[model samples]
Target: MRLTYQTDYALRTLLYLSCLPEGKLANIQEIATVYAISQNHLMKIVHKLGKLEYIETIRGHKGGLRLKKKPEEINIGALVRMTEEDFYIVECFHQQTNRCLLSPVCQLRGVFQEAMAAFFRVLDNYTLADLIQDREMYEQLFEQKLIEIS
Candidate 1:
């Protein structure tokens, strides 16, 4: 049930961007520093997010990153699906690679599927805006992190 770091960072990056004042942009270095993540790793996630049009990037000195879409438009479930490589919670989940002998009669596969569906069902109820209901709190926390880093 653990998400990959890619998904984790992507969400964090989006959260950070959402907390910014209107028209303000943030750089990868600042984001990486804020979360104590690697700049190199964050770069890849940023590139993916940019390609996905989740975040728009502006280059050069004053250039930075901002969300292309409003937080309300960013669905947590949709983002999770895009960021995750696969939903293979078990060996039987992958059709081609599944070698489990019990897969043919396994009720557990259906159970897992139901669990995954339930998981997404909950996530589908939320958006980036929903995650930041306490937007001011998140803003203050990020500000404190920035101060600590400095």
Candidate 2:
């Protein structure tokens, strides 16, 4: 199952913080500029992340954001589950699926469930630390540092 844009951004933001030396601030605007995303949207994501205690925010001069916990402590599966609201693989898999006549007998539900389990299994193998290990390659792929406040 493909991730939503919001999950993608959240992961990217986490990965950015994960790569940092630790206890360093990463400005929201810098992340937005680096990712070519809207600052407004990034702010919302940051607020949610901070609320979850994944990251900490600081205001005023010489202030920005940083991770509250280490990268290894952040479970990818948990992260996705927290950030993603829908895990449906198909239209028939959605909550309001009265349209599917054979849903009761259809093996699609089991298949989808297996598919989702496998997906989480893969994600579970990698922590945010593992994701940002190849820092230069990651920076190159994203065309910017994960966190750049200064």
Candidate 3:
């Protein structure tokens, strides 16, 4: 039930934006360096997030990325749903090409479904704000003191 690195990067990107001062912008390269991640991979995530309207991007000088919505407006569950295309917890969970012989009477499939639902249900309880509750902690972790965003 692990999220792909793409989704992981998206979440990290969003959290980083949310941590910034209001109206401040962060460059993709700066964020990549702070997180010790590849700028190329994060560029894709940033593009997808921009298309989803979760963040806004500016071009030219003084251009970067910023959170378009408030942290409380960003639902973790919905974000995961958009980033994660496949939710098939088991072979029986998928409708297409589910060759499970026990598909007709598989209690295991239902159990897995319930667990996955529960996973999202719990995630639904949280928003980006919840994850960034400890802004000071994240600030320390990122150590982004030099690249000041004015």
Per-model C-alpha lDDT, please?
0.96, 0.81, 0.89
Query: What lDDT tens digits, residue by residue, belong to model 3 across residues 1-150?
Result: 888888899999998898887778899998888777899999999999999999999998999999988999999999999998788868887788899898998799878888999999999999999999999888776665435431
**Could you give candidate 1's per-residue lDDT for residues 95-132 as a string of tens digits?**
99999999879899999999999999999999999999
For every model shown, what is its TM-score relative to the native structure?
0.98, 0.85, 0.91
Kindly report which residue stretches of model 1 are placed more than 4 angstroms away from their true locations once superposed: none
Per-residue lDDT value at 8 in model 3: 93
Instruction: Give stretches of model 2 more than 4 Å off.
Output: 136-150
Query: Taking the tens digit of each residue's C-alpha lDDT, what string does model 2 give over 44-118?
Result: 999989988999998899998899888888989989999988887777778676578788788888888998899
TM-score for candidate 2: 0.85
| For every candidate, C-alpha RMSD to the true structure in Å | 0.7, 3.1, 2.8
RMSD of 2: 3.1
